[model samples]
Target chain A: MLDLALKSIMRSKTRSFLTTFGIVIGITAIVALGSVSEGLRIQISEALEMAAGLIYVYEESDQPLFLAMASSSLSEEKIQEIEDVGGIKESARFVMDIAYLDGDQQFGQPDLFINGVDPENEELLVTESAELDDGETLEGGDAYSATIGYSLAQDLDIGVGDTIELKEENFVIVGVYKKIGDPGLDNGVLIPIETALDLLDTEEYSGIIVYPEDLDDVEEITDYINENIEGVTALSTEDVAITISSVIDQIQIFTFGIAGISAIVGGLGVLNTMIMSIMERKREIGIMKAVGATNNCILQQILTESVIITFFGGLAGVILGSLGAYSLRFISSALESATVTPSLAIGSLIFAVLLGLLGGFYPAWKASKLDPIEAIRYE
Target chain B: MSKTIIEVKDVKKVYNQGKPNELVVLKDIDMKVNREEMIGVFGPSGSGKSTLLHIIGCLDRPTSGKVYIEGKDVSGLTDDELALIRGQKIGFVFQQFNLIGSLTALENVEMPMRICNVEKRKAIKRAKKLLSSVGLGERINHLPSQLSGGEMQRVSLARALANEPDIILADEPTGNLDSKTGKEIINLMEELNKKGFTFVIITHDPLIAKCASRKLNIKDGKIWR
Candidate 1:
C-alpha cells in the first residue's frame, strides 16, 4: 500500500509539488515571524535586566498622542523632594542631546548622542555592566574630560588621550567604556553636567535615574516619587519591561494570525489535490478493490501520500526559514540588536503532519467508500 | 462428484428500489459451479451477466436470496468480511483489463497477495512466477499503458491467479482484445483449468463460451443452461 501511494504521488509530480509549495509558504511564514518576535522579546528582557532595580522619572502629558512632544523637566524643588524620598539610595540628573562627531564620516553623516551627567551620581547609578576599558572615569567638576562608548570610540578611530570637537568645543576622551550592546549607550559620549549645560545653553535636566537602597525597595521608592513629586511620572524598570513585552506580544499575535491563515490555505491546497487525485484514480481504486484490497488499504494509501508531501514541505520550510533568519543583515540591520535564531521545534514538525492528515482525511474517506462496481466503470 | 465451490439460490438484484424508475437487473438466478469446472455465462449487453458474476464473487450482495461459496452462505456477510473472502478464495479479471496503470506488471500481479498480507519477498517471488507463466517474464517492469492489449490482459490474468484462489471470476476477459489475442486468452484459461483451477467466465462470444466445460445462457435475468 505504501509503495502504491508513493508511485501515485510520483505519477503526478507537478500537482504534488504545487500542493507542497503551499505548505512550504505557510510553514516559512510561521517559522520566520516566530523567530523575529522571539528575538525581540529576548533583547527587550535583557535590556531591562541591565537597568534593573532603577526607576525613571520623566515629565510627560497624560495624553498618549502628545507624549512624544511633551518634554517638561522637573523643577529644582521637585528634584530635592525626590532625593529626600525614604527608600531612595541615589539619584542622578542627566541631560541628553544629539551632536555630530568631529570629522567622522565613516558612517554617512555620523551623529552621536551627547549625555550630560553629574560624575559623582552617574558613577554610583551606572550599572556594573558599564566598565571602563582604559583611562579613568570623569571626576567631579571635570570640565574638559569626556568618556566615550566602545562603538563611538571605534567610529572615530580614537581612544584615550584623543580629543573630539562637540559644538565647536574640544574635549579629551579620558575613558572608553566596554561594549554594553545597548544602542543608546553604545553610540553616546558622556561628559560633565555643567559642560553639557554650557554647550546646550540649558540648566534644567531631561530626566532623572533613581536607585533604591535594596531591590525590594524599588517599587516603594517609585510610588513615593510619583505621589510626592509634582508633574513627574516614576516608572520602575520592571514596569517598563512589562509594557514593552505586552506591545511585542501584540505584534506577535498579529503576525501569527497571518501565518495561521497561510497555513489554512495550504491545508486547503492539500485537500484540493487529494480530491483531484481520487477523481483521477477512481478506476485504479476499483482495480485494487477487485484485487482484494480492503477499504482501509485505499484510505491508508491516500493519507500516506498527503503526509509525505507535507512532511517534506515542512522540512524545506524549516531550512528556508532558518536561512532567512540567519541573513537578517540583509533584511534589516536594526535586527542586529536582537539575535534572530530560527527554531525548528519538534512540535512544529508535528503540526505540519497534523495539517496534512486533517486535509487528507475527508477525501480519503470518500475514496474508500466508493462503490467498486461503479468505480470500475468510471473510465 | 466434485464439491460445489459456488452456489447462487434465487438471487435477485434491484437498483434504485421503490423509486419512480426502479429496475431489476437479476431475478430468480439459481446456479452452481463445482470445483475445477470451467463455467461460461453468456449474454448480450444489459443481460445482467456481470451483475451475477459480482454476486458470485461476493463483490455485491443480492437484493433478495442467498449466495453460497464453499457451502457457506455469504449473503449476510458484512462488506469487510466479503472483502476478506474475495481476497482469500476468489479473484476477478475485468473486461477492461483493469490493471492499475501506475504500477508495473509484476506489481499488478503482486497486489492480491499483498492484500492477503503476504510477505514482501514471498509476494515478489510468486508474482514473478505468475508473470512468467503468463508469458510476461521480460515485460514484468512494463506498466499497463506500455503493454499491448493482449499483454495487459495477460498481466490481469497473472493477477487473478496470484492468490491461488478456488474460483477465478472473469467478466468478459477478452471483450477488449482482438480475435487472435482473445483466442490465446481462452487457451490460457483452458490450460489453467486443466491444472485444476476453476473458472467462471462471462462472455458474449460463442467461441469463448465453447471453451468452457459447461455453458449457461443468461437472458432476461434468468439462467437457461
Candidate 2:
C-alpha cells in the first residue's frame, strides 16, 4: 500500500513538489522566527555571566528596563557604605549609557553603548575577558583615552592614536579589546569613569559591581544589599538572566503569532492539493476498490502520501530555516549589532507532522467512503 | 448434481429510488451458474448487462433481491465482508482493461492476491506464473500505458486470475480491442475456460455468445434465455 502511494506520487512529480512546497514555506518561517528568540536568549544569558561571586547594584525606583534606562546614580557615600559590608572583597563603579561621536551627532547617526569603568578596578572587575587585540592600554592618569571593543573598532573604522570627540571632550583611542563572542561586550566603547561622568554631566556612578570574599555568600550578600541599601536593587547573575528571560518570553509569544499565519496557509495548501489529486484519481480509486481494497486501505494510502510529503517538507524547512537564521548576522549592523547565532529547532518538525495529519484526514475519509460502482463509472 | 457456484435470485435494481429522475436499470433478473460453466450475457448498450455483471461480481449489492457466491448468501454481508468475498472469490475483467496505470503488469496481477493477504514471495511467484500463462511474461515489467490495447487486456486477464477466483466475471472483456486483437482475447478466454475455470462474459459479440456453453440476452432492463 505504501509502495502504491509512492508510485502515485512519482507518477505526478510536479504536482507533488508543488504541494510539498507549501509545507516547506510554513515550516521554514516557523523555524526561522523561533531561532531569533532562541539566539537572543543565549546571547543575553552569556552577557549576563561574569565572575560568579559578583552582585550588580543599580539605582532603583521600580524601573523595569534595566539594560536601557538608568535615571539616577549612587553617590560616593552609598558606594562606600556597600563596600563596608562584611563579606565584600573588591568593588568597581560604572556609568553606562548610549553615546554618539561628535561627527555622528552632527549627521544624526545612531549611538553605540558607552561603558564607563573605574580605572583603579580596570584589571579586577573589568578586562576580566581577555588581552588587548591592538595598540596600547591607557596610562593611570590618561583621563581622555578610551579603549574600544573589537567589533566597535571594525565598525567605526578607527584604530589606536585616533582622537574621538565624546560630546565636547576629545579622547584618544588607546586599545581595542579582543572578540569575546558576546555582542553586547564586542560592540561597546569603554572609557574611564571620571571622563564618562564629566561628559554625561553626571556627578556619580550609575551602578556598582561588588565581589564577595566567598562565592557562597552571593545570595546572602545580594539580599543584604537590597535590604540595607537605600533606593537600590541588587541582582545576582542568575537573577539577571531570569529577568531577561521574562522579557524574552513576551517577545516569543509575538514570534509564534507570526508563524501561526504560515501554518494555516500551509495546511490549507495541503487540503487543496489532496482534494484535487483525489478528483483526478477518481477512476483509479474505484479500480482499487473494485480490486478488493477496503475503505481502511484506501484511507491509509491517501494519508500516507500526504504524511510523506509533509515529513520531507519539515526536514527541508529545518535546514533552510537555520540558514535563514545565520543570515541575520549580515543585517545585524542595521539593528545596532544585536547579532544572532542560528540554532536548529526540532519542535517545528512535530508541528508540521500534526498539520499534515489533521489536514489529510477529511480527504482520505471522503475517498474511502466512495462507492466502487459509482467511482468506476466516473468520467 | 454439479455444484452451484453463484446464484442471482429475483434481483431488481433501482437507481435514485425516491427521486423524480429515478432509473430502474435491472428488473427481475434471475441466474444460476454451476462450477466450471462458461455463461455469456448478450446485450446492447444501456441494456443492464454491466449492471447485472456488477451484482454478480459482488462489486454492488442488489436493490431488492439476494445474491449468493460459492453457496453463501451475500445479501446480509457488510461492505467490508463483501469486499473480502470479492477479493477471495470473484475476479473482474472490464471492457476498459481496468489495470492500475501506475503499477507494472506483474504488480497488477499481484494486487488481488495481496489484498487477500497472500504472502509476498508466494504472491510474486504466482503473479509471475499467471502473467506468463496469459502470454504477458515478457512484458511483466511494463506499465498499463506501455502495453498495446490487446496486451493491456492480457495483463488484465492475468490480474483477474491472480487469486484463483471461483468465478471470473468479464464485462465486455475485448470490447475496446481491434477485431484481430479481440480474437486473441476471445481465444485466450476459451483456452482458460477449457482448463475448467468458470467465466461469465458480457458482450455484444455474437461469437462470444455462441462460444459459451450457455447464452442469455438482456434488453430493456429484462433478461431472457
Top model by DockQ, which number? 1
User: What are the interface RMSDs of all the models?
Assistant: 1.0, 1.1
Which pairs of residues clash in candidate 2, taking residues 3 or more apart in a chain or in different chains?
A: none
lDDT by residue (tens digit), candidate 1, B128-192: 99999999899999989999999999999899999999989999888898899998899998999
DockQ of all models, two decimals each? 0.63, 0.58
Q: Which stretches of candidate 1 lie over 4 Å from their true place?
A: A60-73, A88-93, A96-114, A118-126, A130-179, A197-206, A216-234, A259-263, A337-355, B1-9, B32-35, B68-85, B112-122, B163-166, B191-196, B205-213
Q: For model 1, what is the alpha-carbon lDDT of residue B67?
A: 95
Q: Can you tell me the CAPRI class of model 2? A: medium
- Model 2, B1-225: lDDT tens digits are 449999989999999999999999999888899888889998789999898989888888889998888778998888788888788788889998888888899999888887777887898999999999989889899989899999999998888888888889999987898889999999999999999889999998777977899988899889876
| Per-prediction TM-score to the true structure, in the order listed | 0.84, 0.83
lDDT, candidate 1, A260-312, per-residue tens: 68977998999999999999999888777877778888888899999988888
Candidate number of the best TM-score: 1
RMSD of 2: 4.2
Worst 10 residues of 2 chain B by lDDT: B111-120
